[model samples]
Target: MSHFDIFIGEVTGTALLILLGGGVVAGVVLKRSKAHNAGWVAISLGWGFAVMVGAYLSSGVSGAHLNPAVTLGLAIEGGTKWSDVPLYIGSQMLGAMIGALLVWVVYMGQFKAHLTDPEILAAQPEKEGLVDQKAAPAAGPVLGVFSTGPEVRNALQNALTEIVATFVLVISILTQGLNNEGDGLGPLGVLITAFLVVGIGLSLGGPTGYAINPARDLGPRIVHALLPLPNKGGSDWGYAWIPVVAPLIGGALAGGYYNWVFA
Candidate 1:
């Protein structure tokens, strides 16, 4: 595929990813939503299916790695070209941002409605009653729209969970690619991998919100900050570094370990 084709694929794939993934978050966290209270199972399956579809759409040209962790891992494994790494990673991040922007727009009406309702805001005691809390106000109309807070210890645990989850993801991708002689992985494999990701998030992600993809977490977090929403605060910039830094470290370790074991 040409460079332009790869760019387009990455953009579309990332948009779909954030659309489904972020959409599910909105559904669950947002109050008065149809899918609210759907539970972790719903989120896991939603993200898993989203990944499967995104992979099917972009895998033909760009290998559909929507996550930077995957891209970094593939580069380390020597499956992807080093020269192309920058473009791929940049495209993936841009795509994610764009996708998140779309979700923000799509849900804007809901946000506005929630903001207009005094009762809705009052219902969230944590944000409503706090006088000078350290954390920022919620991003969207609903409480905890884009804000994720964990205790100090839980934060570390969540970070560790992401590392292990990413490790499994990278190792699985490498193993599957090596075993398959076909031109590309089939849809079933994509679906199964998606399931695994969701399972990781549902089972292990409770602590830190399962930020398996650095770009996935940070990109949307940026959107939450920039987009016009009532009571929007500092975007949780303090903890933002953890997701970006940890995922890369985890992915690198996984890739290096996989290469060492396989070689």
Candidate 2:
């Protein structure tokens, strides 16, 4: 495939993917939204549907590798040329960032409300009848909108969880073929991937929110840091490396494993 086609296809596909994916998170997390408090199942389904729609639209052109992990895994598996891998990742990152930005625009009022809501803001340690000015800030609501965090702050466990989930995701992508198209996953494969993402979210997301794709987490996270939102706390940069590095490692591992087992 031509570089231009690949870039545009990936960009469009991933933009749609994250737009809907992040949109669901924003919808449920933000207080002013109708979907508020819809909980995890809705989010999982929404993201799964996001994958389905995005893959269906882009599979013909760029194989719907909306994730950097997927691109790397495919490269390692020889499904994608190594030379095009960078373009795929760059486009996916750009797309994810753009999608996150759009989510902000669509939910601008909700974001502002969620961040500035008196109920949430007053729950901070400083407002909890504590006179200490050094009280810790509350980052949960806003952070949930942008990226993931570990439930227990255990790095080793978090990394292992992401590694295992992404290993399954990337490996499945490597082997799941529906249409026999070169490198491109067919319609059935897209549907299966959507359900697979949901399954991963339900089964493996509890520990670390199942950030199987680096671009999916990091791109929006970068946007969260850059955006001008009220009371938006730290992007939690300390824990950010886990999602990115672990997924890449997992993808590489999956690729190597698949090559060893099936190649």
Candidate 3:
């Protein structure tokens, strides 16, 4: 595919990915929404369907490596060119931000309702100058809808969780040939990968919300910080690097493992 196609495909597919995935979280978390408190199972299934739809939509064009980690793994595995890595990642990030913005737009009323609720606002800590970021809790009222935070605030544990979860994800993609060359996922591959994401969420999502995709996490987090919401709390900038860097590490490792062991 041409560079222009790659850019368009990644941007559009990834936007849809974050739109549906983040939308699920908003539905479950926000008050006045019908799906509020629908819980983790809904979230897991929603994300899986999000990936399936996004991949299927863009597979023919950009191979639907919507996650930077997936793109990195494909490049390391020789399916994608290293020279194109920046474009792929850049487009994914842009798409993710756009998707996140769309989520906020979709849930604007819910966000206003949730944030302005006196009871909800009362539960949030004062956001004057929270110096100890690492020791901070994982979520604010609506922060969970935008980005992930750990149930436990240990850096090492959080990083390891993201790395391992992402490792399982990328390795599966590599082994299954989900993003092979310009093929991305066939119908079967899309289904398998989508279900695999749900499986990972069910099994390993408790600790750190299973941020296996860098763009999925970081792009929305950036949007969270920028969007004008009342009592939105801090963006947890200190914990943000793990979701971005660890997944890249996981993807690189998965690619190396495939080259050495699975190949």
Candidate 4:
């Protein structure tokens, strides 16, 4: 694919990925929505469908690497060129931010109602375990709709969770999802990958919400920090690096392992 095609494809695909993925969380969590409290099954399947839709839309154009971790793995696995890595990651981040912004737009009324509700505002800090106030609350009510956070505060465990989950995801893609040319996923691969995502979310998402994609987490978190949502607590900068760094480490290790053992 040409550079322009790669850029447009990644941006559009990643945007759709986050749009539907985050939209599900918003629909389930935000007040005044029909799907509010629809539960985890809906979330997991929504994200799975989100990945499938995004991948199918962009695979023919740029191999539909909607995640930076996948792009990094593809590059290391010799499917994607090193020179193109920056474009892939940058487009993914931009697309993620755009998708998050769209979610806020779509759920504007619900967000306003949820955040402005007197009971929610009063109970927020306590729910986030910030009453003692050692640092900023790591999460807020709607933050999960945009980004991820751990249910527990153990850094080592959280990092390991993200690393292992991401490792599984990248390795699965490397092993079974790549096309013949190694540039991207084929039709079957995309279907398998989408279900793989749902499985990961169902099996391993509890601890840290399974942020196997750096762009998926960070770009939306950046938007969360910037947006003027009432009572939206800190962006959890303290925990942000783990999701970003650990996934890259996992992706790189998957690539190296594929080269060493599977090649």
Candidate 5:
């Protein structure tokens, strides 16, 4: 595929990724929504499907590394050219940002309505009671927005989880692609990979939400911070570092391991 074709594919893939993944979060987290409280299983599987669609659409052109971690891992695996890695990652991140921005806009009305509702405020008795006594201030509206920052926890464990998840994803992709090299497994390979991704999310995503893609986590996290909302909280910059750093580490490690294992 030409560079332009690859670029278009990358952007489209990333946008689809954020639309599906972030959309699920908005569904579950937003108050009175249809998907609210559906929990992680729904989110994980939803993302898996998103990845499947994105990959199938773009894989022919750009190889569909919608995540920076995936792109970096592929470069290390020798499937991607080193010279193209930077551009691929940049496009992926931009695409992710665009996707997230769209989600923010789509949900803005709901968010605003929720924030201004007096009933919503009255419903939270613990918070309302504290505020009435002036012992605690009413929390800001941004509190409802989803975030990517890590909570206080073991940094090593968080990093380890990212590494393991990415490892599984990258390794599976490489192996499957290799197995189907001659037969041109095409879209079916993407579907199978998506299933693996969902499995990883369900089994191992508890710790850090399985942010195997750095762009997937950071891009949306950045959107949550930048978008105007009634009462947003801190972007959790301290914890944000973990997802960014860990996924790269995991991807690189997986790439290196793939090299060693197959060499």
Candidate 6:
């Protein structure tokens, strides 16, 4: 693919990815939305489907490496050009921002309703014990609908969780060729990877929200900080680096392990 194809493919695919993924968050988090209180299972499945759709949409062109971690892993494995890394990552970020912006547009009503009605906090629907991020103490300083936060306030544990989960994810991508299909993970690999995301979320998302992808968290967090939603609090800029840096390190480490043992 030419630079244009790579850029366009990733941008469009990633945009759709975040559009639906963030859309799910808004659906469940916003006070007025029907999907409010749909719970974590819904979130995990929604994100998985988002990845599947995004990857399938761009597979022929950019191979749909929508996550910067995936791009980095492939690049380290000699599949993608190092020169193209920045462009791929930049497009993904831009696409994510666009998608998150669209979510705000789609759910503008719910946002106003949630923010304007301070009583919604007391009216929170029951969860089966899952943390309600929008509630007191747990909500911290920011709304999680636009980004991620830890249920527990430990930075090291949060970063480590991201690192370990992302390490599994990138390693899975690197070895997806060895699956039933054959080498290169075909169209089926997108599905597999999407399921992998769900598995990571279901098993490992309790601490942090399992931000296995850098652009996924960062772009929407930026949008949250810039958007003019009523009473929206801090962006939690202090902990932003963990989601971005840990994923890169984890991806690189996975790629190195793949080269050493699996190559």
Best by TM-score: 4
Residues 186-244, model 3: lDDT tens digits: 78888899999999999999999998999999999999999999878778888899999
- RMSD vs true structure, all candidates: 3.1, 3.1, 2.4, 1.6, 4.7, 4.3
Error in Å for residue 194 of model 6? 1.1
Best by lDDT: 4
Which of 2 and 5 is ahead in lDDT? 2
Model 6 Cα lDDT, one tens digit per residue, 24-113: 888888768999899999999999999998888887777788989878888887777888899999999999899899999999888888
Per-prediction backbone clash count? 0, 0, 0, 0, 4, 0
The per-model lDDT (C-alpha) reads: 0.71, 0.86, 0.89, 0.90, 0.73, 0.82
Instruction: Write out the backbone clash pairs for model 1.
Output: none
lDDT of 5 by residue, 1-263 (tens): 56786688888988888888778877877775677789989888988988988888788778788877777777787877787787888888888888888877878877776756777656555544543333123223333234443322567887888888888888777666633111212777888988988999899888777888878877777777777775553565656777788888888877788888974
The deviation in Å at residue 261 for candidate 5 is: 1.0
TM-score of each: 0.87, 0.93, 0.94, 0.96, 0.85, 0.90
- In model 1, where do residues sit more than 4 Å from their true spots? 123-155, 178-184
Per-residue lDDT of candidate 2, residues 1-263 (tens digit): 68887888889998899899999998998889999999999999999999998899889888899998888888888888888889999999998899889999999999888888888887754542343222223334577776887776778999999999999998998888522234488788889999999999999999888889999999999999999998887677778899999999999999899889988
Clashing pairs in 3: none
Candidate number that wins on TM-score, 1 or 3: 3
Q: Candidate 4 — number of clashing residue pairs?
A: 0
**Runs in model 2 lying further than 4 Å from the true structure:** 126-140, 178-182
lDDT of 4 by residue, 162-234 (tens): 9899999999999984754635788899999999999999999999998899999999999999999988877
Quickly count the clashes in candidate 5: 4
lDDT of 4 at 108: 91
Candidate 1 local accuracy as lDDT?
0.71
Off by over 4 Å in 3: 126-134, 137-139, 178-180
Error of model 5, residue 165, in angstroms: 1.3
